[model samples]
Target: MTQGLAAAGCEVTLLLKAPVKTDRLVAPLTGVPGVTLRRPYEEELLPDLGPRGLTPDQAVGLITRLDTENRFDLVVVRGRRAAIAAAQAEALAGRLWTYLTDVPQNVAELTSAAVSELTDIAVASRFLLCQTEELRDFLESSVPAACGKSVLFPPVVVVPEGVAGSGTPHTPLKLVYTGKFAPRWNTLEMTELPAALAAQGVPAELHMIGDKIHRDSPDWAKRMAKALEDTPDLVWHGGQSRAEALRLSAQCDIGLSWRAPEMDASLELSTKVLELGALGLPVVLNRTPMHEELLGADYPLYAGEDIDSVADVLALAADPDVYRRAAERCAAASAKFTLDRAAERLRGYLDLAFPAAPAGTSPDRPLRVVVAGHDLKFFTRLADHLMSLPGLEVRLDEWEALRTHDQYRSKELAAWADVVICEWCGPNALFYAQHKRPGQRLLVRLHRFELYAEWPRKLDIDKVDAVICVSPYYADLTRERVGWPADKIVVLPNWVDDEQLDRPKLAGAEYTLGMIGIAPSRKRIDRGLDVLAALRRRDPRYTLVVKTKQPWDYWWIWNRPEEREYYERTYRRIQRSDLLADGVVFDPFGPDVATWLRRIGFVISTSDDESFHLAPAEGAASGGVPAVLAWPGADTIYSRRWVHEDTDAMADAIHRIVSEGRFDAARAAARAEITEHYALRRVCQLWTDLVVDGTAPERIQLDRFAAVGLG
Candidate 1:
């Protein structure tokens, strides 16, 4: 939850009771990039804090001492005792934000006492809104205090971008469960699932990926160990970090998230469900209205009490097709709850409770803006627009010199600019983020590769005001991977120049298809070949035109043994399929991209994964109908009608555009989309509104792609 707030561009201070190391896995938040951990907070009250807790006077005195040394704009605390303590600290009235997860006993008293001090109350699940409505209404009617509220689930569980394990489930099925082994959680029944499945002639394995051995649970720990020993084929992986556990869960057949309703009657959320879904793994959880809200009412994999029930439901997963469908549903469900989206939603709630302090420079000076980055190609036109704007002085700084004799002069630049927009998540962003002066707003623009790289992990997200993503897909993944505030991350498409992209289409160009950036397997040129081969079988005039620096041109990309093997295999497939005969054409890298694109009437993006593919947009801008393969979030970036699922679909789209006398109209529609949605001036204006006018980034809308009289 703190990660969500930090990522939402909040200056977060994690007030730790004491710095104590234990058996638990290392927390990512222990020394997080943009958060401070304050300790030595009057620990004389620590032992009493557990059961007895502080009296109202003691609570007031304890907190007042802490505040006298370090003041706070807002204080957010959870739990019954903590909420009471914060409410009693009258010096900090009207800034205490209490986050409620479960409807505990005496919760009404807690809410009533905190009403005068609290800015708002928040719940972990939407179910709590209905459950706590009575308390909220009482506070409103009695105290006349505005009891604002919101729902925020745990931060989106990020699945590591590793090679996903693949193994078909056979006679012996594998299941995994993550979470504490509390008595009320029915851990004994969960661990007994495998033995029950085996008794039914279905050999099974239970991989428990959390600690059963805890200092707090000596008796339950011993019982859990004995249960594991008695139960056959059980692997107890003491404890693991969330990332390691999710990665391990990827290989399992089914996820176990069945929790006994010890609290809230299972109406609240189970993060284990989100973890499994993030890994694209199916889960067997107890059926509830909240589960239906998350995974839909018709979701097939439902379970009930006891071990046999869950085992029988997972037995259906023996069928490959059923397992595939279940996994698809899990992935689809998880996509809706990314950390970025959650953080963005949380920021809206926070705004109502505590409005953001205005961010600007003094009125005497012009709006000093500095645009610095490693890759400035995409920003060429946008930079021109920034310079043209009155009352703004924009300076461009290229960081290609960081690797060479040219040293980056970030200190001087940092001192001069009121707002700095770094073009890529490179050295420039890191430097400005670390050394940015007071009152200077910093924005770092990131594309696809940065999310996969280590730069995001090292970035000081607190210093950066915002990180602009080229597309929402990139923004979502980046928030999860980088742990940056989602509110601070804005989506702005790259400016497409009308002078460069809009051009005349050559005759016979309607049959030619163009694709760029082939090196690296992610480009999926092999998929492009599949589409090319399918199209050529229908008409030989269809040819694939690839413009790239040959596979071996960049040694850094092709020198890797795996990369070389993939490149050679792709060539082997091309030769075997006759794509090289008359079906495919390779053009060496050149400067005249618009001319090359104009020679082809259709374009294709066949990447397996992408943040944003410029080739399709450029091709569309150059008067070609872009048929993009559904990669990651391609459907969201490109119009759904232009995105294709596989080779057959892409080939069919190509054949339809050419054979139905729709080439002229389709080409015009594609160019019109680029002109309205991504044209240099329109995109530049959107940037200005976000940076200069203080408009919420989400409020700026782009034009839609629409074809006239096509129906």
Candidate 2:
């Protein structure tokens, strides 16, 4: 969508997560006309911030900053939380218009947050548009009322991500299934269909991508392997990279989408169905309401209750002419979901949401700002600061907690904002680019973690405007890694409130050492354990107290058995061992920083990398001595320059703090230093100068009230 908008002559800015790298998605967007992409949090760049998860406070603050940064014509979103974030950001910017993707039925009852965030809803089919009425009526009855317009249009189709047309036919029929292999997808169940086809002497093969089953499930891979064991021709290809998967699928003669009878499965239409059909492959799908609604009754090859029925359908599909006809129908159906058509619908919707600017008129209103991202602390502080600025009004926008409760639906609060701020890069960065408000500023803060992962590989960076980085180290790392222009990058370290640092130190606090936030990999808590072991060897009187909330394993998405086992074993050992003689303590729920400071003598940051060391800095403010190891990227322009690489230096620093009994004085001094540097008022002034004086002149704002009712 970002590329499509760029093609339509709109200036695009893309904000993405940390650790940005080269991939297929970035290739097209780079060098695309009128597009500027910025990823602020690439992991390789910033090593002070830990993990990618965001608190509600941080998300709101990020949106506020982005909204104040640049002007955008419209906001389009693909997911519910993203839409809501965009809407809230838009409301802050006082701009309106948002585009939503996905059919209503595809939204789970649990994920209605997307629908609620939209100023205007958009669907891929006229069929889906018709369903919007049912949604509207539900919204009016279920909630208080429904506002905004809902329109149906075609799905936005892109050139195949990995597959290209084979342009040649093979004798043996190849059947391909692409998409995440979750329980709802029932890919394992469909193994029977392929085995049955092979048994019946039909030249059929099943290829599956994205196996999501637990690796520990002994029967997981065994079930499929057993089904195809007898038939050497029946192949169960393991998960493949997106490009490899697409290339392999394009070589096939038939595409398949099989769903179990689960409620979520029955209602949602897989993107595979659309992509395969778009690629001119005949799709054989299970009979479900979603399929019927999407393909219509005339659509052929709906599998019945058993594998036998699917096998029979495969046999019939092997005929050349029958296959050809199906392929033609798929091609025709695909045209209805082209990116151009989706863009046109969005354009029309925007036309209705915001009327054209009057001839010879200039927009003089303060540019509205909105920000979105997962970091709550950074944003909360940032928002507080932005709100204090003279010519700007900043409102924090939070979507995670709301989305967790609301599902993916529409949001009523986002109709008023102007600009949006976000932690530019992550798994869901694309969601923001798709659902931007018309004529609003889109500012994105890039952190370090996104730079090294596959998540940013999928972002269309050309969609974002100015990107704010926490440090020069992060900025340099992002440019080198993602190849974004340096001019678009701005350095803005995360700020905090001084009042929040006023707690007193507790007696005997010298016995405790603290570490904050979660995510086992980034925090390198295991490494911290290693340090604890070393510390115990040096002094038996030392003890460790670690505070962290529930790990990601508690969430269904990361609930793999291996992950669960690792966390459990690690926790048990940490609880049972007496390496330091004084024993270890685990506080699943710790008091806020002020209270925690009273009990902690020193704070330890053993993180592998970070965008900003918020915990250590906060601990310093609370009077805990800061002991930070040199992060891997500390030598770069993006990391904090304070990191020391010498282990002896680090150990000595800890020893000095512990032996001197200077905890109270250190805490008081550290608090004073941080409070002055990161105070909310100081940061807000910087944001105001950047938003109003930096990018305000380039904005092209349309008069929403004047242009309403014109589409």
Candidate 3:
């Protein structure tokens, strides 16, 4: 990755984990134009740390100190420990881009601890770097935080010059294997391939390059040592330079890479295979999914686990026609992983990660704006973001109740402000619509609750410049209900502060489901319970956590006989069912929802209808996957992937997501979808354009709105 970035003309400083003596330097990066190797910490700093090198806290301190001095645009760290350390440390929050190379090889190897660690890194980093598409998929599936953030930054295969295969097997066909002799890699097993091929009436020799050997088992090591010394057709060349390795490998008829089943299941592609293919040598490897994608299923050299399978494949490769076809296929496949291609990919990722600032200039004086609302809970972040803008001066006109406000203060602020924005289309909106002056712009945001009320009909439509709805579904509904002009209404989604909400998930969060606000009977607490019952039937670990005020707390709802009956019946059902009795938990409502969401893995929305249910969206922004019932107009507000038709489908989706080990990927997709459509920054831009320039949101195109009856 460093080489590819350097090749793209970036001045990259490569930080060594432990201090290395400058006198003993490798020749590979000696002349790289834009690369520098820096050992910031001295040997004395980590004297007794052994081969493990720096601990997470030690790494954090070292990186923090170095970052302060260098002021780096991006800090690229590799491995789980380094990424977790960087993510948890406030000093390296926004700039850390982790290259995740040391994760589990497959879903079976993906443990709960690994998932939690990766999730922490995913939420904190700018983006997660993947070496292959398979690895990217695996990472994204295991860690929800990695869904939209994971990007491909594959290994750069530098092909040596003047090395090419003959496209025909030699008289005594030579087979070669490069890289370490590890137990799982099956390097020791290659010693038997030549003799096995000879039994099939095909003469062959096995050649091995690399000095490193992982002596994992004493018995295997002893057998490997004896084979290297006594095997007639085997030649072991201990650790040669790249140039020497390629030159020696070029002399061979085929490259050998078949490994043990466990190693074959890995999501990573072999760089050595690409290197051999760059020399125009066909590779004989295990028939894994990644290998099939790389060389194609018809590449002719794929082998299974048994020695006979490898031997059979080697004998088949001895045929000139088969050898030439395999060689061509491998060379074509390897072309995509060249150093230059890697450099181009790196440049593209960098361009997106650090885009050029958009051109703009501030106004002569800040525009005076007043936001009037009875409850600004939904609009506080939007108000705060607007105030931070360069050319905006904002103030709030707080009301005592929905229909009651200080008349004198409202008039004074209205007269003083250039623009007045009524957050809800209630009495405040009516006052602004009736009193709007010639030079003043009055905008009313109509939520679903206000649409049900008489506020829209009572408002002076002629004086109001524009009415904003949280979704196009609501916008169309409002237009029909109020009989407003085609162009009088616009659609802008409710905002979610992604930076504030995208926090690390707590351990065991994947099994904990959450539901927010079930005040009215229509919010569908029963449906949520049904879904929870279904999930708990499959896995007892599944539990539902409800965060809301009790039904009795709402006077209007509790006073109704139907509401009381519904609660009584729901309580009786929970008492009867084993799944519901122990699985349901209700916590008191509080303002600290962001903190509360850390323990929730999935957020359920089983409402019969909604304006733009902000709870699920907020949960998504907090890295929790939303399992929503397909309520009326739900598709417009959320992606169809998140909306299930019934409780059964919702339960099925939640179960499949967890059982298939794609909870992270599913949650990430939800989070990315919500953040992209309704982030605070994007909504603020729309508001600024409307408040300052009197421009309609581009999404509210005249033709599209007219087609959808929102014109």
Candidate 4:
């Protein structure tokens, strides 16, 4: 990968954890053009962190020192510990591009610890390079933080030229295996292949390379040693260099990579198999999903765990026609991993990771902006983006509750700020407005819930410079309700982190309907139930998956008699209907909504009313089509096509989307819309203009098709 990046014109610095030996594989990369190798042990007099390897502290110190001196564009780490160390450094966390192969790669093996570990690194990284598509899919589905940031980056194969070969089948087919002889690798079991093939009336020679043996079991280790020494028609060459391995493999007709079932189910593709394929040799491997994707399901040489399956594949490989076809397929599959192709892929990924800034977009003088808020959930991502901007330094003054905060901290932050952004139009905004210093700018964002409270009425609008609203309708409403001037109101739509939300949907997601935040009785959980029943009546496969906290969990909402009664009635209706009862799944609320949305094909927003519903927009960002009911101002916020008149119409729209086999197309279009309008980049740019440039926020119109017929 280092060589490929260097070849792609990137100034690469390959940092080694320890000093390299003369015979090491990486020894050749030293002093290469466009590549500078750094051996930390040899360069710095560092204390020994632990036995035999670099510790996280050592890695952080080395990387920090190097970055200070050279100012690298990106820092790529290979393992979990290194990524964790880099993530700990606030200075370099945003620049990390992690390629972690050390974690559990398959869904079945993924544990909570692994997900937590991966999430920590993923939240801090600019990109993640996955070695296989299977691993990428697994990560995106299991780790919410890993969604949209991962890209496929399989092993690069540099095929040697002028290898000798013959199209005709040999009398005795030659089989070869190269790598460690571990129990799960089935290297010991592979020695029996020669005899198994001979018993099946197909003569074969088995060549085993590599000297690394895992003596996990004493008896098995002794048995393997005996097999290497005395097994007929089997030759053990121990271990050899890369060139020698290829030369030895090219001479053989077949490469043996079949392993035990545990290893067979791995999400990773064997590099040795691809190398052998690059040598123009057919490889006999397990029929894994990744292997099937590489060589196609019809590839002739797939083997199973048992010896009989091995013998059957070997017998088939003895035929010239079958051998020729397998060889051609292997060669074609391996072509994608060529060094030139890998270099091009690396360059393309770099372009995506760090897109060029627009011309003349120079940074302004440094600004210290303090984002003071009681509940900053909706604005946290915006704050993080602001911190990433070139000339801005942002800090958050988090409050204890909606109206409670540390007065000392809040006062200190307000006094020191060039601009103070009150996330919610509550006590934070009121306090900042009342305590504004001379030359200090104050901006307060008001959402739907804040308008109903007395805080906005009590807030002194004269002291505030601008009041931000999520929608134009809400902006006008806020101005009328709070008596703020039209010039003081700004309509900044809530942003969806499109990159974080967009991910590959799981199979059967097309039948799943999703609802987020069905609380307070006003969100209309009953209406969502009606839609689910309507859909299930047409097809029992349709199901509703609701992700939110139970209404009782919210004290204020549950305390209201109407809200409690509404939920009880809704539950009874669900329990009464057969189609609706078993078809609905209630998942507890959590932060991993990206992962949760993988199984959701449609986002249902059948609310009684909303100022600017964000769930459907989030769903659209995640490639799930939105089925929004025609609430007040719905057409202004969303395309008319997504806003249906009622639950029945919403159900019909969803059914039509599925029955016409246009679910993929519909979701693609929806995702494109979200990317164009509500994407984080566009909204971030608007916020940057408001905060840094002191540009007045405007009441912008959405739904470009509002004046036209339904689209």
Candidate 5:
């Protein structure tokens, strides 16, 4: 919604509920014009209510203060309290347009009563609009008719937030469903839709968003787990803000409009459908009279009564032209129901509700905002970059330094920061829980190390506003093992500053193979040794140069006696032999690895599992042939099919590198490709967009963050 309004030339100020340190909401929205964010001081106005629960009085106070300070043109309510608050603010301001993203049924009766006071009630779908109708009718019949004067606009569609006019339609039949996975609305039913499609040989996937509903219902959660187990095509995720949800939905070829068979549901249309259509995604909606009536004959596929019909629709949607025409029709229909159009229609109603302000008003300067987080080095760099922009002040809170200065722990440091970025391996959730402030955006970067450790189990993902992963692979692993919403996860691959590592690629170094980093178990030093052995066995001219930090026991092992011995006997030998040999060399000093990688001809990784093998990525970036073992976790976590395994295949790859003499061209091409995807500029841009704008692109949401919660 922010992006859509920003694209339409509206300056945006996002009032987050909590601190945003990670790129969950901002990275995807960066580079977009006309949007600015403000990190307001968040205060917990209602202590009795938890994060999801807010009372009418508390809601009114928050909205009134925010509106008084900024006077927004349109106020969008996401959760229940937010809706009520927006409505109250609209009533007070007497001219603010209001839109609700969630189903009205989810809100408390009292909160709903407050929202009914708004000038206009906007829903995402015809189904929801009807649901609003039922609630209105009930309220009117129960109360006085004079109390119900709100207008209902069913199914207002907006372009998927952060997606620009790409000119080409989305391909590959990708379908995404963004919502909570509660039983009342049959959320889990869609979880099985993907596997059902795959079973019938229809290529399709269902990306589930939002937190697991019935979380306390062990039987239901377990059944949901079992149902989605081994469903490779199904990507389950948890709750996310509307901005993050739409950003993710934009990457799909189609948007799913499937809801449970509720009388109220039949009258609603999903926000996903509107977003997908706005982003040029064709849609497959459940057959409902309103959908049929609004969409007319242009409805490409309809799952009338059976879930199996979804597969049939998906199979037909695979054709590019078929999907394109459907998307075009949906887009044409969506423009009629956009927030801009809705706000225009609602202006008169709003004017009637409240008196107008004095004329000749000047807009306030873009909100001066600051975001703070952990890893001072990274966030400092980010802060520096963001500070270069106009009307923005970015700060970095180094908890370690703060402790030195004031003897305060992580909690104290977080309380002083607006946006907190904690290391995935650090005490993120604990600090946030201890010193949480309302309107502070909590962003956490889930690095590769945490994915393999018990940290994920310990972390409270629900408290986190967004998580930035270095790769989609790690994000998927975290989602599968940890159960985080894909929308809340953003994949911002590691950034290497090309200018800093601009040393020329080494010439005539074809025989030198390099392996960087010091990890043994996961890095699989044994595989690199085996590759070296194979190369030497083939020709004595072949040699290996490994740069791993020493002492091997200190650096690689976890202080276990047996583990230390294993490292000393196996990995240390490779390191020691290479160091002692005249031709083979090993440098365990803390020198720059990128410069060394340029001097080597190839890089190898024999890992059991990797979120993303950074060594190989760096090696490839430095103009080396990358030979990586097809790791295990990718298949279960991300449905990966790009690994090359057999020992012979490894040897064959090595032989091709040596015999073909195509190393230079291959190296250049590999460098170009990896740099384009993982360069520091590109990666930082992703972070900036996600952190600054609070939008997570669909591809990053799906491929990186698999699902929310510990599934």
Candidate 6:
């Protein structure tokens, strides 16, 4: 849990029984980032932090102070009175859980605390619920306060080495056991099975590798010695380190853990079963609902918890094919219990612990920010930036509702968030604007397409806190077209990450022209071809390159009746015109669009109207001199040199830049303009100030952003 959480951007602090002084012990953990290793109490204060060595008061006091100083989100503890201390530590921690072994005393102890406190509980298994009849009702009814808090939390294994098949033909079916040999485990019955198997002409060897029994079971040690002495084939290797034990187990065949059905400890999912299962060693254990859930009902090695049933496994292991199939099932079942995968399930177990921060609460907890929409291609950098902050948790669920418009699922997601920014002006914005839980701060960003869509006008503008626009042009257009409140709308220019886009252009790329989007008639594909024709007429080497999804693949355009004629004309022109047929190039849109954009000397934006014209901004960041056509709001966003009145003028400017050998200079100038106006950090800071600090967009002085200091 510590290793996985630390990797997932959580600041982890590991508390230990003793200070790790050895260099070899600490060296491996040195490079795990954002992890702090510390011991809360001195060794003298609590020698082993045991019930006898130190009082419960001392342990609780030390844990509570750690919670106070470090601000722990959850306090998870296991075994005896430590569970009691953890349940009481709920006062200081965000959430608390007592990981209990699935036994009668464990359930009773937690039930006593559940009535007094509100801590979550994670029991070992739901064994009683599935196997026992009357006890199932008693288990859930025992702790009324822990109705939804308790869960079956099984131990997860870290299967480092490859899992090997247990059965090897003519290898005496090397049976091994790694855990204790207690009477409750039916160790005497297990030990006698090897000799009985040898009498059946299926020779078997058993290796027992364990240190000691549980605290109260010292008598089982003497029983284990007598049983091993009686059996010639049973050998005791004593204790082995966990790593070496796992390695040694891989060499063995059938794993044995057949116990009586009445054994209380065996009722839960055993760690011993998992240990053998993870190593692909098929365990000969009793069949139960929990066992079936772990290894599936088809597991051939399951016995009736009897000595004769365990001896039956030797007959199967003697057969190469049947043993191989059973071994495969064990290996397959082990995959789900891996530490990393279990850590994800652990998140679900920990979810009920941390309650949702109430709306308008102080920054005492992480500000929950949820960015939800279909077209959130632009919000990734900002979302990532927010997550890296000290007191913020950002979740970007782009295209979450693409399969269905299920309102209930969307609301459940919205309840956890303090602020919800609907990226595109579509169904997500419409849904949140209508279903908003009153406390959530809703901000929806509208681009050009949504201005034409019906959902924008359908939005409940009253409930929306703000409408973010990539540029003032889009803000003005949406205000007039969609009739949204002018006061609520603000221009926060789309962020362009300059560092990732900038790259060296290919040799002889000074003559190549690039265009990003080529769909929707307003883009004027013919005009782009005309401009390219003029440039190509001057020099045949001048080619226009387009990188976007192929036109035929756009299902929405094909579905729209009005777009049919436009596409037909565009494709006909593209097929007939020599300049387009030969001089123009097209490639599918991919992750490396910046690399494709870098090969062009100039990027032309020929759209009739645009809110932000991200293609030209991205092209400028890619060190490509942008040749932007004059649109209604183009001049406000870009300089006059980039904006041209017509196709001929756009062609003339490109010609002038090439003729004067100013491609490098123009590229540098374009990059500098984008750097000054549309840098990622600079724009994200504007958004941070608006959503987090509640500073109005108009109040944000872009020139004085450096003075405000983003960090």
Q: Which lDDT values do the candidates have, in the order given?
A: 0.69, 0.56, 0.81, 0.83, 0.57, 0.69
Ten residues in sequence with the least summed lDDT for candidate 3: 702-711
Report the C-alpha lDDT of model 4 over 174-267, residue by residue, as the tens digit: 8989988888888878888888888888888999888777887988888888888899999888777666777787878899888888776576
| lDDT for predicted candidate 4 compared with the true structure | 0.83
Which of 1 and 2 is the better model by lDDT?
A: 1
Q: Alpha-carbon error at 633 in model 6, in Å?
A: 1.4
My TM-score estimates for the predictions, one after another, are 0.47, 0.44, 0.63, 0.84, 0.43, 0.48
Q: Which digits, one per residue and each the tens of the lDDT, describe model 2 over residues 1-711?
A: 676666544677665543344464566677788877665464232334446543333443454556567745444444444544544443443332333333344434524453443323221111112122233333322222122123343345675554555533356778888765444566666766656877788766676665445445576656645654454455656666555666777888888775655533432345577777777788887766456656766667787666787888888888777787777777677677777776675565444333433222235654455555545554664564455333455555554641232213213213455666665465334555556566655566766766787655566666666777776677777888878877777776666534334444555677677777655555666656766666676776566777776577347524766656666766776777778334566666443444445577767788777776777766766666666778754433112222455545555556555667655555565555556555544555466556654532122122321222101
What tens-digit string does per-residue lDDT give for candidate 1 at 1-711? 567778887877766544345423336677656776544334454444533334544554655676787786566665545665655556766566555543333435446445443322322111112212223333333332232232234436656677243545645787888887876667777887877787777788888877645446787778787886676788877678777777777777788877665432443466677778777678877776566766777777887666677778777776778777777787788776677876786676565444322245333566888888877877775775666555677887777653221344667788898889888787777888887899889888887766777777888888888788888777788878777777888888776655445656666899998988798877889888888888888888888899988779888987789888999998877777764566777887754565566588888999988777878888888788888888888866777668887889888878987889998888787777667677765676678776675454462233244223233
Please list the Cα RMSD from the true structure of every candidate, rounded to 1 decimal place: 22.6, 26.5, 10.1, 4.4, 27.1, 19.2
Is 5 or 6 the stronger prediction by lDDT?
6
User: In candidate 2, where is summed lDDT lowest over 10 consecutive residues?
Assistant: 123-132
At residue 538, give the lDDT of candidate 1.
Answer: 86
Model 1: residues >4 Å from true position, as ranges? 1-365, 400-408, 699-711
Which predicted model would earn the best lDDT? 4
Candidate 6 local lDDT, residue 285: 80
- Encode model 5's per-residue lDDT on 1-711: one tens digit a residue: 565556445677655554454666566566667666544333454446445444545555666676778776555444544544544443554333344334334334436445454223322111111223434333333323212133454455645446733434333346677765556556666666767767777666677676645676788887776655556677765567666677667655677776656633432456666666777666777666556655775578666556777677777777667766777887876776776775554443333332232122112443233343344554544554555444344444454431232225444556665556665445544556456677777777776665677766776767778887766667777788888888877766666554334334544567787777646555666666777777777777776787876444464375666656656676556656743244456775443454455567777767777776666656667676666677854332221211346555766677676787776776675566557666665665565566555666444322332221111
Ranking by lDDT: 4, 3, 1, 6, 5, 2
- TM-score result, candidate 5: 0.43
Collision count for each candidate, in order:
3, 129, 2, 0, 51, 0
Candidate 5 lDDT: 0.57
* CA shift of 347, model 4, Å: 6.9
In Å, residue 357's CA in model 1 sits off its true spot by 27
